[model samples]
Target chain A: MKPMLAALVLLASLGVPLLAVAADPLASPGWPIAQNRFLTGKTYVFDDRVQVIVPRDAEDSTAVPGFVRVQGIPDVQQIMVFAELNPIPMIVQFWPHRLEPNIGFRFKVQQATPVRAAALGADGIWYIGGAWVNAAGGGCSAPSIASADADWAERLGEVHSRIWNRGDEGRRLRLTVMHPMDTGLAAGIPKFYLEELVLVDDADKHLGRVEVHASVAENPTLTFDLRTGGSVRIQGADNNGNRMLGEVE
Target chain B: MMPRLNALLGFYALLYGSFAAALDYQLQPREIAAGVYIFEGRQEHFTRHNGGNIVNTGFVITDAGVVVIDTGPSRLYGEQMRKAIATVTDQPPVQVFITHHHPDHFLGNQAFADVPICALPLTQKIIARDADALLDNMYRAAGAWMEGTEAVAPNCRAEAGKLTVGERRLSVLAVAGHSGDEASDLMVYDHRSGTLFAGDIVFHGRAATTPHANIQVWLQVLRDLERQQPQILVPGHGPTATDSRAIRETAAYLEWLDTTLREAAAAGLDMAEALELEIPERFKSLAVIDEEFERSVFHLFPAIDQEVLHGGAGNGTR
Candidate 1:
């Protein structure tokens, strides 16, 4: 071996510290770094039970539908979604307080990348699942249709939400809010997006909470499965401190 | 010395051959009227084979100079279009009127830099703001054909009134809705030849792209154009026609698209489900209809869904 290689091998034998190599299931260059950042100092396993469902190809990079459903896990507390190669890699972090471990939302994909979902179970284990999404890219930086309108600010924080009862499949609530969700990557646009959103039952009990990022699409849509059919209120605040409030029956 | 001369000749031949093969649009201008000629483009989408030349471009030779309408998709196309105009008429081009701010229609503005390139005031603004992104899209779709191509903003504004270019009295109309909210589609009517250049407002056989379209308003604009009733019509795409068939065809397709999207939204179909919906048999003959339909769905669905599902109130004000 070369002298440099011999020296490195000798250092390794002497227990020199080096970055641990991670075996990423999707074989993405961004996965190791993203994993380290999002799940810092936390151990994770590639679990098939932690399901991440997304289209094989994003027909529209600006709003690609994605869902995460955790099965075979009895006690799931937290869930996080990541698009490993997006400029903003962490798409969302959810806390299912009284709701099921299922979420459906649309997010931007800057390029073809690995989309991952990690469910933190009551056992303190991070179970991860992921899929590859092919894309034409530029989702994060493209100016949204809302940004072009002169009066988009007048209608800002407008929320439209609906509930559907699927009986055996459980209840679903879909909420859409009007916001630019700008990543600020485009020229002459500032970063603005919903920072946190919480769903509350009629009794003011927290059903679920989601921390959103700019990686979400403009006019973000968040769908969730409810444990029971009842009226709920959504309260949110954007990075610019704009209040997004709505109620759905 | 003889050997060196032969090598030099070989080098020139190779250079000529490569240039000929790579950037040749093979533009053929067909005269539709007296002093009015059109270089009809192919019906295919932007590809390396077609070099983004999928839109019709034409010119009118007036007593004083040549008035060009709509440059093609790339810098090479614009350069070649200038050369082709030279072959047809000796008059230097005095003015260039861009039909709309779409990349295919105005990426060639660089070729007419010396001429006063004109467009609607709004079209100029939209082009200036969105030109970079649109040009980037052209590069992605057309590849190497866009080499050295840059988005050149229109230099002058074509106001909504009669313009006397040389001896030709042309009526310039500023219309909207065919292109999106921020665009103003420009149509020019030649009083002498009785020919109306209906920009993207009229697509003959090809499907209309709706990345920036408001269909209801677009239909109303079509009705306004039909009332003018020019003897000859030069559509933005497809063959030049002497009748109003192009206008009717464009309106019919847009009407169908509008109804389809509304019904799909009313039925609460998701974007993916709407994309999978079938197209009628009549529209199957239109070139690139499927791709355009999907693109329209992507552009129009989310807004339509909100309108149809929740009575058009985008939530509530803060």
Candidate 2:
């Protein structure tokens, strides 16, 4: 979603129409959005250079495949994924240190939502790509069908992060976390999910920026475009203030 | 004579085509144990090509009458199974045991209309609750295969206890079938032959479906069954095993999934990332890992996420 349209969707989804108050969260937001310093006052454009690929129809609601590609850019700074229909629509803000403008990943889609991937470049301008995906819509509410084993309790919160070269100039950073990403919509299911995610270098320098929406799907997956081969680390917290950290090579 | 031969061949071809078209898949029974015959189903989900023939059925020949364990995916399958069983035994299936409430296991109940169809009380209740929807889904997935199919609830409750079938005494253990604490699965053990009819509990090479299952209890039950030393194992979807190896195999896979999901959750990866995970070398050999495992992650990740969010004491929200 472009900056204006992302804000435009906020107006449509939350029914709050305001131009002056759209700059910051405290001023006024269409909804409750996680505060971000980088997103302030940015005019986003519908750029053909950016392409967001998502199946028009989701085969599986939870782990629906998606990708973002930024053409004509050698070094892209950040990519942000958004599910316009989700209660929390900021799927993830990704920073790629190796530095390509392309990434592929998957997340949940609740109903038919405009899945938007916004690419930020060195020009400080934001380019947006989007697709309308018609999902059966249980990504958030459906029960996780992984295992019924009692031992799975001890294995929770584990992360398996990997970086596979795209064979082009960029690489794919894939990580799997054990989380339900529950939306509390299902009967008796509470809203338990990851609330924050951060990408950093060895020195803890923020590589890219990201924010996740409740529609991120359970056991969320984050994929990023890596332009260079460098050491990177990921750290995040869930709603209960539980924190996790991982590194990808 | 040549014209007559050609005419005879044409008549036979029409007969063969109609018969083959109606009974698309043969219900070939393989005797897994003494008086125990089984029909191994294909390792695939319900699709038009498969005709919903993705369930295993077993028939036990007793001195008094025959006892059938699980009807196949459709009424036609059950009819074919009955005909196949009759070829080996004179007695008809006096009683039919519905392993669980899965459409593939119980939709064939119409063919067993004459006999008492038994299921766990919870299974019957679930069947009753989701009958119309499940049937509708089956029809949508496999149109012609589900033509004669109807959702039939078990009239008799299959309680966990010892029961006599002719001269043989069978131990019917009610096992926790789903994470919901419903006896969604049943283990029928024949002490006489040491054969364990593990319905949907022990998937050897076949991938177990997790739509309505509790993996924790299932793993524990498989461990217990392994220790009991069943001579022959008859799973709901895979080839029968002579040893308790099937139990161990199924338990190991669930354990692997437990570890994978736990690690992924801890790292805060989303379901999509987890779904893209590479199957371990050991699990790569397992059938349906490609199709079944991803679906399972979608189904199982939610509950696990809730478990961790609540600090392992799950909120019982699921």
Candidate 3:
């Protein structure tokens, strides 16, 4: 008991989620057991309010599609996605000005990794959602299409949004932005992509959001699980001063 | 365990489609001219949703039987095309003409196995060479749509000349400059109806794909095609055009792309800078313009840059 207490004190001082890991030794690595800038030192309870969708076997490693949803939370300010296997790790770090609900997006999954999404609330607590993405080869270094292609600039900043009721009392919202989420791995290619995405309801109610990473595929896509069904408003920004707003009924 | 579960679910979906809803390949062709019928495919890229049905395929009913212009993207599309043709005319397609070696032009040859699917010898050779890689990419882009699709090479050789089909005289010519399969992309000029079944050589509304285009040579081919002065020109991808002015539209685009890529390469702008280069406002209205231009620049611009500046023997993704 003395040793355990000492370890807890050490972990608390280190600002890690080691206490959560210590509470359940059998917990998966995805159960928030590491240090995060937004999640460190904050008392966060494990809640199903945040959910994620990851493909078990992604056919195209370069564009592994996934979705993250955050609901039943108030005043959410930011969200971040991290792929454990990526060389750079954090896929996206979003600072959405509008409180939009959820996002479905594609990731440049380098290899098989435990991908996690962390949502930061106004109360300084981060809710986490995670899944495992299995891929055969490297999605990061495969001569990404964003930087190598010359016509990406003309098509940049175009946004397409769609909303559909899953019919299981849950609605889904998907948004695709035409921007090369460059990971800066390729020679001569700069790190350019959507940095943040925010979702809001018809009443301008703040919902779930996420920050994007360069590991995201070109023409970034975001899908979200909507707890409440109605008109949805999406807002996102990129490394370039490009802001796009979309509405889906 | 997850993949196993997914595999099991896929098996069940295959066995019992009623449990899970899937895409239905319902193809219906519309008659554009007398005997020349065209199927306007979905105006989208090859994806899981579109199921690879993104190529314009037409069929002409001759006195002997039906002559198909180009098979679609997959065996399923070709099979459905056969069924669609049966609804229009009872005669089966005697000769299936593959316009080029593009998968959209040949992969559906499996559906017309009984018929003599004909193409240029070079086209056949390139298709034979790139069959495996092409099918692999197609399967990756379209999962279930390529289930039964197999790469079936064109068994019959089609020559450049007036082909006598029963009573109709159809003049077949080669137009090579659009893509890699040089001298393989063929055009069929119907003398009776004044319709030109122009393959990938001419893109009307869609931004032409320029993966292996010799733009200068392509320009020359367009001028020659315009000289034919066909009443209707059915392009490989988009809607059919009635006037020869469509040829100029395609030529202008190719010339612009060639000039832009050369200029960018000469200006020491790398592929990254070239990608960010401004697209002229005129080509913005073309269908799939963004995606098409990006793909062309990715595959072509860097090589042009190297050939012009670096003196390196650049590699072009074939």
Candidate 4:
């Protein structure tokens, strides 16, 4: 009984089941862990014409491999898709259905997070693909354009978009917002953050919304595609009810 | 006890030798071109150990007064530059042009307190806000090399525009994409010598540093410089190369990086893998290729994607 008691005491000294000792691999100093935490549940099929390719180790921050395939989409046509986190959450959507079964683009991860891509097939089924990114540093918390509140306030409602013609019916549209999509990480003068909510709408239709991260670069630019010719509008508002709008043609 | 004492003395000597070696700052001033000089110094920091010597403080003796381009890394170095200039000319340096806000080029401005210093407006703002941080980094890097000195600061500022000194026409273009502040372009047209002082814009034998750099806009600025076609080019660092070939080479290097990194990014290659990929044939033999290439690639990969893929604006003017 003495020996058993002594063994128990040794175990206790070794910090077994101590509330203070938590198992957190990420908390270890200088240990390399996955920086991107993007997770995809299942490959969602939009239509028989569209094929989505998702990478296996999407958790790695430095690499994200993906492929997109769509049947009947003409080759040489522009392909547009949106990552769900865009202030519009539409990463890059473009028009004129290209026939190529594959399209690819490389993007920086603001954090270890998941990226969802939604492709609008010619048949109108939103094919969805997802990838995770492990990136270093809090990219979303990086500083953006330094402008006065009054100056940023004046350009609230103006939305602008530039549609590039890939030489034919294919069109690539790039959109930008004039609002500060404050991610609540930055300090404004008296230790306050410029937190705000922004919405992107196309022709009175709800496109998507993004929880603005402070790490986004100033004048957050979004490039996407649309099969239809219509105007897009962006609305932004801070917690204080300051609002601004912009339009793209 | 005697053996132990001998071992202890050996250890102390080893430590002292290392400390003394690091503290020694070797600065060599080479006359690369006629009436043009480059004060080449080593960056005494671990972060900048790429063997890319610090090329700060260049002097051009003009009919009016000596025109110094870039003020060395610190006040002491700046004084060294002034002394070097005095060896060649009796006239005081009337005007100083800061190529950018990098501490190695601008902190020494304090050495020329009496001389009027000029830089792009953006550079002035960056120096005003980030100079302290830059100096702290320098001090930490120099360690024993700067054992007995305080960091110096820039005194005068230059608005972005044109200024004429002697027969030279200096134009401060607001080139950005390198630092938040500092001109992307510093075009000095020396009518007498037909030379253009192309700051850090063109590196002759080494890959360019891309921290806080905008590759696309930098390429555009190079194109603009090429169009001017100055007879001689005096780079901010390294030996000057004649004609716009250096400009083309620098642009080509950037383009290769842009395309290669873009492909790697598209393929979902990790940053480390991308860096490990064999360097192109063009840049294989350049000095500091292996030492600094990785860092340049790391900074440039994301910057290029931001500008080209994301449609981010060029680095200059906000």
In terms of lDDT, the best-performing candidate is: 1
Residue ranges of candidate 1 with Cα displaced over 4 Å: A1-81, A93-104, A114-138, A141-158, A164-172, A178-211, A224-228, A235-245, B1-20, B163-169, B227-229, B266-273, B305-311, B314-318
Tens digits of lDDT, candidate 2, A1-249: 599777777776775434324342112232223223334567555566777766555657776767677788656777887776665567767665554565555677667677777787788767666767766566666655433345655756777576655465455566657676666766676777776667676776766645555566566666666544677787878887778887877
Q: What range of 10 consecutive residues in model 1 chain B has the weakest lDDT sum?
A: B309-318
> Would you give me the overall lDDT of model 1?
0.85
Residue B3 miss distance in model 4 (angstroms) = 4.8
lDDT of 3 by residue, B98-203 (tens): 8888887788898899999899998888888889877977887787878888888899988999888877789889768877535767888777787788988888
Superposed by TM-score, candidate 2 places the C-alpha of residue B40 at a distance from the truth, in angstroms, of 0.8
Off by over 4 Å in 2: A1-249, B1-23, B177-182, B316-318
Q: How does each model score on lDDT?
A: 0.85, 0.72, 0.73, 0.53
User: Which scores higher on TM-score, 1 or 4?
Assistant: 1
**TM-scores, each model vs. reference:** 0.73, 0.63, 0.58, 0.54
Judged by whole-model lDDT over C-alpha atoms, candidate 3 comes out at: 0.73
lDDT of 4 by residue, A27-133 (tens): 42211121112213312242335543433222222223333445564342333343333222233333333122344333334444444444554453345444443
lDDT of 1 by residue, A1-249 (tens): 599677777766877522223367788889768876887767677889988877666758999877788999987899999998999998999999888898877899999999999999998878899989888798999998889999999879988888767667777777888899999888999999989999999998889999999999998877788896679999999998889899998
By TM-score, the best candidate is 1
Instruction: Using lDDT as the measure, name the better of candidate 1 and candidate 3.
Output: 1
RMSD in Å for model 1: 7.7
- Model 2 over residues B65-148: C-alpha lDDT tens digits? 998899877777778778888888898788888888888888888988999999888888989999987787688777777776
The residue-level lDDT of candidate 4 at B209 comes to 70
